[model samples]
Target: MTEPNTESTTALDHVHRARLYKLASLAFDRPDEELEEALVSGTFADQLLESAAALENDDLEEHARAVVEASPTDAAGVDELYSDWSSLFGFETGGDIRQYQIEYSPGTLVTSGDTLADIAGFYRAFGLSIAEGNRERADHLCIELEFLSHLALQTAYLENEGDETGVAVVTDAQGDFLEDHLGRWIGSFRETVAEEVDVEFYRALGALVDTLVGDDTDRFGAEPKTFEETPPSPLEGLNDGEGDFRCGTCGPTSSGSTPEMPMGDRDGPY
Candidate 1:
């Protein structure tokens, strides 16, 4: 019953929100050494608590605690958690969970043709791009979360600078992007993550994303439609205008290139 505090426009809240999104992005990605250190060192847990508390959301605090409790506190535990992560979502380990929004989207390719383009547009407009080492596409859950994290962090900066116009643009972008992308399918994806992974940590993280996104959905007055079932990949005809993007993580396009492509330059404030 803990709703998002709509009046909570403090820079600190925005910072906390950004940190939470960044943490979620890193948590869901292929477990790298940085993530391993955060997990074993308990920095991950500490930050989760700090952010959840900053948001003043009871659900987030509870889920954050669950994640903390379930997190690995040692090297062997981290190894076990990473192994489970790889099994559930890693390409090298035949990760089966659909972490991309397009995978959860229904209808034919034409209907969803602009999905990739739209997501990339947001990233490009904000001057953010997927890292070269990334294995997933822009439509991937982690990337979308990271994009939101960027927006939230920007909101804090803009607010601190007293740039009202900038704050408005960034916050509106966050709500719209979530409504169109992450908010729409996050709950379903979270459930799948919990069901597919063996570790309690992943389950807790899934719950955390579901709650965090749900809170934002409410705060933004966004009514994103949840997917009932994951349909087969329809990546062939999907175009990003420049042939710069392709579905690679959930499924590959005929071109063999991936949607990990950079968000091309887009001018103006947005």
Candidate 2:
């Protein structure tokens, strides 16, 4: 969502947005060998950095460049990222960071309740539910990013079909989703992750996600709520049983896809 050269109307713009979401989704999730290969071969980093370079955002371009330069070139380097990922996001690491949106969205209480239900309502309205057996909640960072990917794709489709009304509806939903959920907490999340992680890979990711969310906020004029009082403490229950997380999308898959849901031609009440 780095401010596009033009409005998100062109085919190239749609493709760029899609790529941004996909990369962000992978970045926030646990690292694996497939992702390592993509990074080392420059397949993922090159595309992302190239897109950022095209943007007018200099900070984004710089972070993307750093990510490309610091990318692991061998299995050992990838293993280092995996280890860092575990320490940063795992339950056993005594980490204060929580990836679920509800944990961060709350003002004083760091527990899940209505906020989680409302987030699930948004997904269900779009015919999306966590894939069966996917233990991650609807508000998990990776799930939210993947949902944005679907929204971007839907916007692209509407644009292609010249459905201005549909585009506006989806665009409004995007802004609403950001304002209510991701935008509200991503700044704090980015700061926490950057402070907690030791590896450059995650640092770059924090920068990238921060940049994108900032741009999205500006584009949509979505004012993120401020933490007037002290932010809530990290809820121990949020990470209590989050055992050995893996990238559902990029990890070794024995059957179907991840918790990702595709929005083809199905009409939903956006």
Candidate 3:
């Protein structure tokens, strides 16, 4: 991961916190263009956008728990969370992206039989799979995001006269983890997920991951590649001279928002 340059430490801290909150907000709201922008911005934005886009009700309770438990001071508690996640989600080994295929099977959200515990498990698996691919740069960005979020929350707690020092410690630990471990392999992992995963959520996630990494690097003085610089859009050359355009999928529609294709018509996992 690129080291943050010698900027105003406090300013950087504020930017980091703002970015974290923005990511959290985007995850909840799921706006189309803004979500796309967030994904193209950084690793944190990528993870949050994909996670949010694919989020099901089953995972909300667990996310809430994680938010509460992720304090700056609780190293043991944080380790426990990581351990539980690894056991359930199977950490990546051998650095072979293909290995992840055998570990994570694609599953759907089942609202009927879902419990809060089950939902949390799903998120654990999802997050772990993201970390498996070993893209160091991407992992670093994600770690920073997580650390910033924890710090912001802890700062809030401190302002309220709650324990702040421990929270700060946890934030430091999380930052170290981001810098040392996860940041190393997240980009490659995301790419592998995008290429290998058959699920729509995962594919979109890969896109988001790409976007975020690219955006963050740009912010930090690195010129990262973007999706727009890649292959021609499917919508390219399809636009007519006027504002009105036809739909390639459904044929001959007026100039308005194109309708989504029926889910049943899609070839891959829904």
Listed per candidate, the RMSD to the true structure in angstroms reads 12.8, 14.3, 19.3
The better-scoring model by TM-score among 1 and 3 is 1
Which candidate would rank higher by lDDT, 1 or 3? 1
**Per-residue C-alpha lDDT of model 2 across residues 1-270, encoded as one tens digit per residue:** 332222644645655766787887886677876688787787887788777765557888888887777777777877887777777786767656688766655453344577888788879878898888889878889898888878878887888898988877777777788888888888877887788767777788778877987776776667768433245345644543664333333433245554665333223311
C-alpha root-mean-square deviation, candidate 1: 12.8
Q: What is the per-residue lDDT of model 3 for residues 10-49, given as tens digits with 9 covering 90 to 100?
A: 3334344445445643432212454444333444434443
| TM-score against truth, every candidate | 0.80, 0.77, 0.28
Clashes of each: 0, 0, 23
Q: lDDT (0-100) at residue 91 of candidate 2?
A: 75
RMSD of 3: 19.3
For residues 41-146, could you state the per-residue lDDT of candidate 1 as single tens digits? 8899899899998888899999999989988888898788778877887777677787889877886445776998899899999887778886566788888988
Candidates in order have lDDT scores of: 0.81, 0.73, 0.38
Instruction: Return the number of clashes found in candidate 3.
Output: 23
Best by the TM-score measure: 1
Ranking by lDDT: 1, 2, 3
| Superposed model 2: Cα runs more than 4 Å off | 1-9, 107-111, 228-270
The reply for model 1, stretches above 4 Å from the true place, is 1-5, 108-111, 231-270
In candidate 2, the residue pairs with backbone N, CA or C atoms under 3 Å apart (3 or more residues apart, or in different chains) clash, namely none
